[model samples]
Target: MLTDLHKQLLNDFQRDFPLVERPYLEIANRLGVSEDEVLSALAELRDNRLISRVGPVIPPNQIGASMLVAMAVPEPELQRIADIVSRFPEVNHNYEREHRFNLWFVAVASTTDHLARVLDSIERETGYLTQRLPLVNDFFIDLGFRLDLSHA
Candidate 1:
């Protein structure tokens, strides 16, 4: 069960998260809670799988190279392959699709050469071929979600 604080933590910080040195303290002050409470609630949220991470969303390929990669993985091997891919720090997130190329992930690295090397390493480790799709155009996709907790 989520308390009001948990919902606020998720909803409020989706945008304009503090960039200050003591970010949790700032959040705690705004919420009228102690810094420890904010920290504890965040840990609880993560431990319960309500949230995956708290981090900045950089614009695609602005500071680094990124590619959308697909792999035609066998059904039985999907979980194993996904685990291997997720282990790479370069991979942001991966998901399944109902297509021949069933697994897809976005990989970001400091340089194009580094990105390619990471992809090559993934191919070598997973024993699967990767179809790299570089972005040709930019799109504005809103990635934030407001947790409507009125009924909760």
Candidate 2:
């Protein structure tokens, strides 16, 4: 069952916690709890896989460059290729998508050229060709949705 505290935390995230020096403290204050409690709750959520990470959602284009690279990973070499890709420091997130290009990953770089080079390195190491898709134009569409726990 989702506790009242968990529900409040989710609601707060959907509304944007705060933009301040001590954001956690602010959230704790609002929740009528101590800062330690707030921190502990967040940690518990992450440990239980309810929340991934509590951090700023930084836009790659604004700070640096990022590209979505997809690889046509053969079934036999899937694990080996994934291991090679994960070794690259530039690769932030990697996943297997339901498509011909099974292995999908994002490599954030200092620049567009750097991003390309990172992809090239992956191709060289994995011996798997990559299809690089850099965001030419970005449209930020907020997809934040509140989870329903009433049934629970």
Candidate 3:
């Protein structure tokens, strides 16, 4: 169950999230509530699977090396390998495609060497070879989801 606060929080702060020492507190102030209320609501939203995570979405390869990696994982091993890949903090997200190289993901690191190390570790652990596709151009993709919270 979501309240007006939760709806507003989700809809208003998708972009231009306050970059402050106490962002939640700032949001609380803006919403005319105590910081604890905002945190509690956010926690409740997380617990109910209404939200996934809160973090900055930096441009790819801006502060580090970024790679679009793919793996030809057998169908039986897909879920397990995906779980292993998701454990790495460098991996943003992963998905499956209806192709031989079905498992695809993006990984970012502070440096090219660090990215290589992460890929190497993935290969060593999963026993699957990594195929990194080079970035030839940049495209802007909006990352916000406009929730329809009318029922809330």
Candidate 4:
């Protein structure tokens, strides 16, 4: 179970961890805790899988290029293919999309050619044809779900 202080810190700074030189110090000061405590609590939360990551989530097309690629991986070989897909630095997120192309992943690249190279490499490695779906039009969907303070 998390202490109240940890919960408060998570609620306050989950979206925006400051980009200042001493980010942990700033957060610690705001939360009335030591920088070490903040770091420890974050580590604990991550270890427990309460949070996926504690960093900036830059939107697609903001800096580097991104695409939603999927592959029709066999169900028996999903985990193996997923592991192969995760080896690439270009892949930031992966999911099992429910469609003909079941293995969906986001690939961020320096250029279009770089992204294509990743796709080609995956095709060669996994022997599965990748379907790259570069965003033609993006709709910003807010998937924000507040942690239940009542449970906290």
Candidate with the greatest lDDT versus the true structure: 1
Q: Model 3 over residues 62-110: C-alpha lDDT tens digits? A: 7888999999999999999999999999999799999999999999989
Once superposed on the true structure, which residue ranges of model 4 sit more than 4 Å away at CA?
A: 16-26, 34-36, 76-84, 87-89, 124-127, 137-145
Task: Give RMSD to native, each candidate.
Answer: 3.4, 2.4, 3.7, 3.3
* Alpha-carbon deviation at 137 in model 3, angstroms: 3.9
lDDT by residue for model 4 (59-125), tens? 6878868889878988999999999999998998999877777898999998888888888999999
Any residue pairs clashing in model 1, and if so which? none
Off by over 4 Å in 2: none
User: Clashing pairs in model 2?
Assistant: none
lDDT (10s digit) by residue, model 2, range 1-152: 56677777865676486899998899989889999988888888788888778766665688888888888887888988999999999998999877789999989988888888888888888888989887887666654666876763
Reference-based lDDT, each prediction: 0.92, 0.82, 0.89, 0.84
**TM-score leader:** 2
Over the stretch 1-152, how does candidate 1's per-residue lDDT look in tens digits? 88889999988887777999999999999999999999999999999988888778777899989999999999999999999999999999799999999999999999999999999999999999999999998875756876778876
Give the local distance difference test score of model 1: 0.92
lDDT score, candidate 4: 0.84
- Model 2 gets an lDDT of 0.82
Q: Give the true-structure RMSD of model 3.
A: 3.7
139, model 3: CA deviation in Å? 2.8
Superposition error at 96 for model 2 (Å): 2.0
User: What lDDT is reached at residue 11 by model 3?
Assistant: 88
List runs of model 3 lying over 4 Å from the truth.
Answer: 19-26, 76-92, 117-129, 141-143
lDDT of 3 at 120: 99
**Residue 2 local lDDT, model 4:** 81
